[model samples]
Target: MPPRPRARTYDPAKTRAAVTAQLEHVRDAVRGLGEEQLAAPTRLGDWTVRELVAHLSMAVGAVGRHLERPAPPAPEVTATGWVAATAALGGDIDDDTRSLAASAAPAELLDRAAARFAELLPQAPGDRLLAARVGAMRLDDFLVTRCVELVVHTDDLAAALGTTLPYDRQALATATRLLADALAAKAPGGSVEVRVPPYAVVQCVEGPRHTRGTPPNVVETAPLTWIRLATGRLDWSEAVEEADVTASGERADLAPHLPLLA
Candidate 1:
């Protein structure tokens, strides 16, 4: 069968603004966390709050570095492929992030990183193509990945701190749509409708397609819950038992296709 269609086209201007706004929000939250809090353990296995913060900066600042280089001939991958690309550089990225966090004060590093992103981001053109290590992808398409990092890590920070940080609407929406599309791409099914309330809804899993009325299979959760599930931060069974996710229908179970980033 052909690949399931990707949902939710993002406007470059809106996406850029969202990334900027969300990064600022995360930086502001980071600034408030004391050194002790910054050193706290995160769900991301060996990564403390410090490493996570550094990773966020790496994600945002990468666009600047790519933009500084000449544009690539073409995008070797789609935004859909980016979700898979993340794992390839995991080791090196984590190493650099750990070194950066160790050498600088978390607060100061966040400040400098935010400033650098602010300065370099504006220089990138909307249509500029980036030669990402995983594959060539448009600068705008790459920004969508940034939104995922910013949103997901922001949630991680909040979870570790036992507090909630305000999420930028656009950032949350873009992150939701991207992950949802990634799930559809990975599963490539028309059986179940996965609904992330107030942000996105996608049909995935293999079965008979529902053309009208209620689908035979349905799964539902809020955006953050879905993000956590998709990224392995939350377990499917736990979510299902805690009422964080609602699932139904014979084909509704998505356990096999989950934790897409791992």
Candidate 2:
């Protein structure tokens, strides 16, 4: 894995709106799930639909939970650093998700989470530090990570249900950019240019830096494809083979450093 990269800032107001909007998208869809549908298996290991939805609530509800407590002394990580640190917490996340899943109906869980998040967002200062699961981050930075959480799992839930869910434009864009920045941080260099059209384009993978017209190595894909690739839901070679990802030059093979935050 690569070290954390330079920090990126997000618009605090837009982040708050994006988080709420994306959660609304999820809550609306989860409200219609039957008992059997809640039990459906998802691609995330053994996490069923119920557990996945529970995780979403937990991810958002964390804001109020954090705000209720004393603010941390200082931010320990940025949004990108939070991304780099998430892989090690999988076991704890699973345990907590299962516990939360058993505590309430999916819709209710989301309602309370969404409600509390909305309530707290108005009073909290953007620079206030929350002791997040991985470490402390500003309220705004933490919410940016929440966008990643909501957008990524929205796709997961959609896949399990054999349908598509809408993405809040800002949420999807934030998630795509954060994950793309994480990839660049993990594989630091300018040898390859990764393009997720209309959202992000980052130079990464250590080698000769491109300074002129067209770079030798370039990888291009849709925003969702890039997100799935960064999070390990989509395989690099598989994407290339399926015509979902276009890679040029030898350095474009990113499988070795993939699943950056999964």
Candidate 1 per-residue lDDT, tens place, 164-248, comes to 8999999999999999999998888798999998988898887798789989899999999999999988899999999999999
| Residue 190 displacement (Å), model 2 | 0.8
Evaluate model 2: give its TM-score: 0.97
**Residues 40-145 of candidate 2: C-alpha lDDT, one tens digit per residue:** 9999999999999999999999999999989888779988888889999999999999999999999999999988887888988999999898998888889999
* Candidate 1 backbone clash number: 0
lDDT of 2 at 106: 95
Which candidate leads the pack in TM-score?
Answer: 2
- Candidate with top lDDT is 2
105 in model 2: Cα distance from truth in Å?
Answer: 0.3
User: Measured by TM-score, how close is model 1 to the native structure?
Assistant: 0.95
